[model samples]
Target: MTRKRQGQQGWGPEHPEQHYLVQPRTVAGGGDVRHVSEYLRASGWRDRSKRGGPLLVESPDRTLRVAYDPHGQPGGWTIHGKATGSTQEWSAHLGRQTPVEIVAGITDTLPLPRSAHAPNVWGPLADGGWHARFEGNSYSATSPDGTAWLQYRQEANGTALWWTGATDTRGNSWTGAFTPTTPLHVVQAFSAQLASPEPVMRPRGRVPHSSKIRTWSVSVTPSQLGAWQQARINAARAATWARNSRRTDRPSTSAPPYANAGSVRTRR
Candidate 1:
């Protein structure tokens, strides 16, 4: 007898690829360029420019591609990818939102785990406060309040069972299990368990009083004050002169004339 992999029992390789196409509520413009650029960069898309055409953004692996037109048809960015299902997944992730909303969405959906990790199966959660890490069939997450772990087990019948466990700051422990149909409930319970009360900090020692201290008073004549001001100016000029002289005396490290003969020097 042979054993089937945990997640591969019911899953098939020819599953329909997920595709998403998000049309902005408004046309792409200068106002949202930064946001779009950031999303593309974070998603591992690089700009591929060509002669006499719009700019193309492609994934490093060449599995995904995107193009944007601020003034052309569609009036927004168009995303496409191979049958890996990432194209639709990214499109759905982008969702139906205005430019600003999409930017916020991108900001929230970050620090995605590697493809081999369980997070790739669980996906990003609604809660953004916790930091998550994965190892093999188990994953752990920690927030300001507490920490939690989720582990997967393969039953004899090829049914996958997930065990959700957590411990709060108050020394309370909770554990539960769920099938694939109700996995979100496990996540919700885990998130609730992680919502421990915030800690309060109190000062430990009495602050020192400001009154009990020795004092000394000195007065400078007008001439002395004038001399001090003149000294400061002279020191500043001397420092500036030293810096300029050091720069002037430094040896030239420029390349030979042939290397940069065609380069133009612009006025400072």
Candidate 2:
């Protein structure tokens, strides 16, 4: 169990190797926004982040605005993308607890071309044995253990949403949502991770676990954890090396729009 340092000297890549801790269901504590801030800087997003201010950046086109100011704003992230150049292009405000990996899933894919207009959002959750229910224009899904849920509504209902959330056995929950303008593929990326039965690793001291409930927990030998860590390190190095080889140095554009009011609340 070790602490993950912030900033991108070498501290990035989508998945950092998991440790002994489990990401608690009730509170959003384990993920780091730096995982994303660093990627944005590397992928060519202009690092306009001022010292002692919220981490900030913009796309080359200047349409997308991503800001990470965890303390100044407990919301954690504000992603704005105006591909359509409309007031409603797309925007998402992610809370402090939203897992950085899932956020990466959506943001990282933004620069890629979207040829497949329609993506299957439910398939991944279904594969994971999550149940789906649809009534009229509203659609939703929930995890088998009843610790997570996702919903998408077609009609504009004040604030647009693609809520993806998970709860721990104790009933605590953390949530992240994207707007309607956001790509389904992007939303799917978030959904797919939530649908995953894979355990989320954290530092052992920080995990929120009751004496007997550990459905999301897994035991790993030190040797196994070590090997897995080294492999991930190697992969990250290879990726960085390849990027350096092919490109000059510049990061790029990312995830998107809409804003009003939202929150992450634990279930009592």
Candidate 3:
């Protein structure tokens, strides 16, 4: 008897045709084979692959939905929003002007959480909304996902100053007075100083071995910060028309402007 070769298929070798079977599936589309309960269990492949394309998919519930600019990416989940609370209290440091240090965990002591961000020293327009001074850094409460509300931090000298926004119940003054139209799921905020450093600070004698201890002089007045706060309030208001504009857009067309000398606060 002659030995059969590995690649050759003949009567003597295991019949290959017998191994192949013809079966039909109920589902017409060519997708992964999964139970109705497990809709996309075996379903593989992304629909469109482009910068902004749509995605083709079947939900776990077996519902089919068309997504724009298909990326064949995984389905996104929903996130719940959270409120910063109804109270508004803040502390102001008079040294220069900067974001008040939100004493960690003691946020409740102020008005909202000490965790809230301070407003920008730069003035807002007659109206208010998000302000993206630089490329895309915005001073607005509300995340890309629309699940969070962010605020700005005010700084003076080289440190944080009074934390504004979130107002008191009596419409007096408190820590956090601002409330989000939608609850904040993610808390996002930041602080910064004048790029030139001339507006907010003054040059002190250079240190023997370190950078000069720059001082902050308010470019805008407390009344200005207050006005900016009001603008913010109007912007946050749901019925306000100013909310239509972007927040980063400053009222003054002047380029790279800073706040006037106000007050300063130091880090504790």
Candidate that scores best on lDDT = 2
Model 2 lDDT, residue 87, Cα: 40
Candidate 1 stretches with Cα past 4 Å from truth are 1-30, 42-44, 85-97, 100-111, 114-268
Query: lDDT per residue, candidate 1, 1-268, as tens digits?
Result: 1235634564333332221111111111113344444445544556785767665667656755555554564344444435553322233112121233222222212212212323332333225355666655555554423344445566566675555444433322334344543323223423332232211111112111122111122223334434533543343344335544553221121221122212222211
Per-residue CA lDDT of model 2 for 110-201, tens digit only, reads: 54445345788888889988889995777898877676688886665665468766665442446767888776776776676666544445
Question: How many clashes show up in model 2?
Answer: 16
What TM-score quantifies how close candidate 2 is to the native fold?
0.65
Q: Of the candidates numbered 1 and 2, which has the greater TM-score value?
A: 2
Candidate 3: where are CA atoms >4 Å away? 1-214, 219-222, 238-268
Report every candidate's CA lDDT: 0.36, 0.59, 0.23
Model 2: runs farther than 4 Å from truth? Answer: 1-18, 21-28, 72-74, 85-88, 115-117, 154-160, 168-172, 210-268
For candidate 3, give the lDDT of residue 253.
15
Tens digits of per-residue lDDT for model 3, 237-267: 3222232443332122132222332344331
Instruction: Between candidates 1 and 3, name the one with more favorable lDDT.
Output: 1
